[model samples]
Target chain A: MTNTIANIDKEEDYFLNLGPQHPSTHGVLRLLVNLRGEVVKDLKPYCGYIHRGIEKMCERNTYPQIIHLTDRLDYLSAHQNNEAVCLLVEKALGVEVSDRVKYIRTIMSELSRIASHLLWWSAFGMDLGALTTFFYGLRDREHILDIFEETTGGRLLQSYNCPGGVMYDIHPNFQKRVKECLVHLKKKLPEYDKLLTGNVIFKNRAIGVGLLSKEDAISFGVTGPSGRGSGFSCDIRKLEPYSAYDKVQFDEIIRTECDSMARYKNRIDEFYQSMSIIEQLIDNIPDGDYQTKMKPIIKLPEGQYYQRVESSRGEFGVFVESRGEKNPYRIKFRSPNLANLSALDHMVRGQKIADLIAIMGSLDLVIPDIDR
Target chain B: MTNEELKQRIAQLCADAVCTDTQDYVLAEIPANSLFAVAKQLQEQPDTQFDYLYSLTGVDYNPELGVVYHLESTTLHHKITLVAKTADRENARLDSVCELWKTAELQEREVYDLLGITFNNHPDMRRLLLDEEWHGHPLRKDYSNPQLIVDLIK
Candidate 1:
């Protein structure tokens, strides 16, 4: 009698710790879950287990070096992170990159976005017990990494973005390889839907589960695919059009279901949009310098600058305060992962424990990104 | 609404609120005590409905300490930046905006953990990135840890 709960027939809750090291968490994020039997009553995400104090570090590093540090935040969207800082520096400096540079950056950024989403799809599938998706998603992602490695020398960090433009010219095979990769991914993407999206078991697991209403998404400040899944329409690439985005033609995918399946479809559809963006610019890259010559040292006028980039996950904002110094006086990165992660509790409450995994998988959170 | 219109609307709401519309966002400096009221006006007032708090940070400038709140209107797609300062440096405090934007729950905790700026009425106020027994805010300009410091060159 003492061992069992007195109100088991009624309603009683107990805490279950997910982990600061579990594989399903995708990193060191520990989620404190309040459960009533098999159903979740509350979920609290405990972050910062891997927090490296990036903002504090950036406050000490020079402007150019900050780009490299950004690469470490959301490693999947490293190029996009680099672009955020570069845009801020460029705006502060008032230097215009050549059209060639803009085209190249946009193409590269799209490529990384696809790569990041693929990796997310892979890990997400694995999170939901579809281990085969790991092999397929990574198999296609490897080709994109090869392309990046050929040009940038680093696949993960890919610190190609600089203040005025990219760090180097695109490899001569950039266009041809990109076109070939597009051809392969186009034929292969539908196979993803066939394997997981259309599967009855997967659909049963995702549809109408972990519902996040549009209002709740906004109040939680969620963005990117997570918000788009709820019809939030906060895509920075379309709304603000940075780099060469305005010249390119692509649709901002939106789904009103606001369930785990909707979030799943959002990233899948983005792969098509990203492909279209790359196709529009593949052959149109202008002839010009890869980088605008810098003044040896970079500094900004005394002011506050904000730059938002559409990372694979969501809006990655960089807020820089400079008092006319080589290093920023204070640099704050408005991390999208943190904002998206904050809404997990609201989405998972009253859902089953297994549904929590599916919901968290659809959230597509990178622990490093959240921790940063 | 345009930046000028937003500035006018904010001015109409609070006579003492000072705003600087020169930067990308409509930046404003308001008294710490009036932070909750001004934040509510920015969120509930249909003309300036800033329903999103995308970013919240604490800044340590030696003797002075302050908080930065970046708000955005999801429907209108307009953004603004608000700053509130505490006269008490070591014991800095401000009203919490978690009720307005749920995202502030963790961000305010991070600010409190890193900069030692207390967010009063914060749902759960504790050290976010450090052990609960840890001492001193690591992000403060005067913060020094000889145990962790290393020479970059030499």
Candidate 2:
């Protein structure tokens, strides 16, 4: 059987389509993989399946209206997306948000980061056939969602961020609920390590798979945990502190291994770092108005404004080119997922077909983020 | 280097390039023909090693097409914005920096797909977000598909 298999396609490479609807893809991403037997010789990712022309739409919409569209780009990191737009508009208009607003935004951003990471963990575990891990991950994620729904009034697509500040003040129980959720997550994160991180089967499949060097990570513009895994210190939060990131004291998680397991471990360690950030800022929120006074009709000065935030997956940048109108001349989002996904083909080459799933899961791509 | 030093350095490097110290970043407007060379200098020079190309965007300036590149030096922690505009909109073309920064490959394709600006020497210069048979570049100001896009603002 082995001889016959080898003789059948000794020099020929076969192609396989892995996604566009497959469960492992996590979204509408299609990978055309060329395989020589089980080893993947080349991989090409075809995106834009969920392209809603968000950039084109932004040109037609006003400054305030554009915030909602950002939420749909990286829905998992919806708060961060909204904040990127708000920060851009605020900077363009020269509006200084109150300290209270800054602290609240930072805390909420960290909460959403935890929530996004949890969902990624659940889906990644499911992709690798660890069914029990999904339930464990989502069970802890619920507390964060509950906190979001209570304050932002939306579970997933929360467009809470406005140009001047958040849309509305936090709910009365926001602080207490956040503390409770943090307490719950701090206890539950250890269980996650025991379940998936230490498993012998997972280690064999993950360790040393999809080795992306530090040079490749920087060249491809891969940021967040995936970039940090390759020892590329590309954390926007640390480098260009936006919002209340300057006040927070948390270590930027970096792993020099440059493999799938390194990426996995980076994200796992980030859970503690995120929690620590939230813990520091949660109690120290100052007393002031949640929002500042702003003109009803928002129009940025005629110039280019760019703002970047450290989203859960990577650096989410909003570039606004204004023509001194209510609407922007051209708006482009430097989506982290798109940059991260661009590097997928480079990382997965020469690896087994099965390891592609592990590497992809480690990337934690949100397709709409890429498509937008 | 500070924005002033970087501006002077860039000015020295590219004689015709207009360098402005913007509020956020050092904005430099280079001629379309010399963009690739200036970018190469920006990347290769030890003092101005703008290794990371974070964002590449194509803009439709009515008759002229433009591409804006946001580059950063991870080692130096400074950013520079390069704007290159084509003289003719009909045949919108610019040099591809994918050789210098791999991030430009897909972004250039996106620019080509949406704004109709083709990147010369791009390995795979194909439509990214839109289909091949798509009639017009939807992001362009003049691109009007009455059947698809409704003029909500008007």
Candidate 3:
């Protein structure tokens, strides 16, 4: 090693390949980072190291069969993506979902959002150098997944959403188990705040780092809590009311600060909001059929339809162009992670190496979601 | 304003652009060249502050091509569908909305990478989610998978 170093010119700049393997990267993301003593001059995020051509696969599958593929896009919050696609197809076919189906889907989506944000909070803390919060966050998340298993029969990739409505009706004890799970999460979330949110070092590491102004955020099409942190009101649930969101009452959380801390605080705030939404929906489980009866051979009209829904990361849109066939003529998924990832080049332009990890965590780039 | 009034107003901006005016939204088709101007006007309007660019996607019309923009105004709470039709399949160049909405940049790149539609003056127009040496735009009808195409030739 010493001989090779001696043979190499001292003036040549060294490029550090940070990941597609680094633990702090959060996913299979590689950074071609130009460094000058830990200060990053240029950072390029190389993805598609995990692309599976999900869009092409969706084209081959039937309308109902594609729901399972959507489950894998953002696996951390599979229910949200699954519901997003199911509702798009339902809207396309002009199918009327039952009231009970709407309430149950609402409950499931919110629960998934809470689980995603909780994991993000823990992982974000760990990225900023706190290791214990990872275990704490995952411990609480396990309870939510257990509840999901009770209802959806799958842990992470819950293919619960179907075209007409859902795969099946909620289990009889679904409400009781979800309520118990909520009680446990509510108790554990406060401990998370105590462990991470108020920590002196965590605040110092995240505050004022990766400051995204409101104008910049809007231009970048950043959504979810990231755009909300910058004070752009981009919540699809609030903007375009889908499923049971119109009937439900919840606050559209916002923060005008537009910094890493604002982003962090927005997720923490969303955890409580998600819990509240789940509680309200679970308590008012309507009595009716779980799915609407539709034609066995489902064919979409020969036209273009675009539907957008809010996912855990941000606005997720499904654009389906049908040629009056069982399968979509052309389908496009505008996953929020991809849109949010676009701002990374601008966001991490002047930050340090350590700051890069913190900012990347704040952006929450799910690699498959981006690649798909 | 009601959906009718918004449609009428957009008609005033581009006569006969409104395609179908449903109860919820008004769909309009603008010339590919006029998309940027119409989108800018929508953003500048007091009543229709379509400041948020929700989604941008390209649709293939066998002999022709089209780009669709779904826009909404958070302040006004109105939704509009703007369509831009290219002259033919060979050349599908539309004015970039990146100057008006930043979200359009990545969206335009995706369309370029997938559908082979070029966005003039896009700041950093490059392959977003694909490899740099990837052969053809995957979403295009004529596109053949590199591996499959290679296997066929052999």
- Give a tens-digit lDDT track for model 1, residues A92-179: 7889999999899899999999999999999988988899999999999999999999999998889998888888888999899999
List model 3 lDDT by residue over A1-372, tens digit each.
998889675545457898888988778888888877667777766777788888888877888888889888888868888887788778777788888889988888898888898789878888988889889888888988888887789989999988778888888888898889888877887888898888899888888988888878877889999999999898989878998999877899899988788998889888888888887788888899888887887888777777778888998888787898998888888878877877877787778888988988998878788887
Instruction: TM-score for candidate 3, please give it.
Output: 0.92
**In candidate 2, which residue pairs get closer than 3 Å at backbone N, Cα or C atoms, i.e. clash?**
none
Candidate 3 docking classification? acceptable
Highest-lDDT candidate: 2
**Which prediction has the highest DockQ against the true structure?**
2
Tens digit of per-residue lDDT, candidate 2, span A79-131? 99999999999988889999998998898889889999999999989989999
Worst 10 residues of 3 chain A by lDDT: A7-16
Pairs in clash, predicted candidate 1: none
- Stretches off by above 4 angstroms in model 1 are A1-12, B149-154
lDDT of each: 0.89, 0.91, 0.82
DockQ of 1: 0.72
Please, what are the lDDT tens digits per residue for candidate 2 over residues B1-154? 7898988987887899898766689899999889999999999999888889999999898878899999999888889999999867688889999999998999999999998998999999999987787888998888988654456555
Error of 3 at B24 (Å): 5.5
Supply candidate 1's per-residue lDDT for B106: 86
Candidate 3 lDDT at A61 equals 81
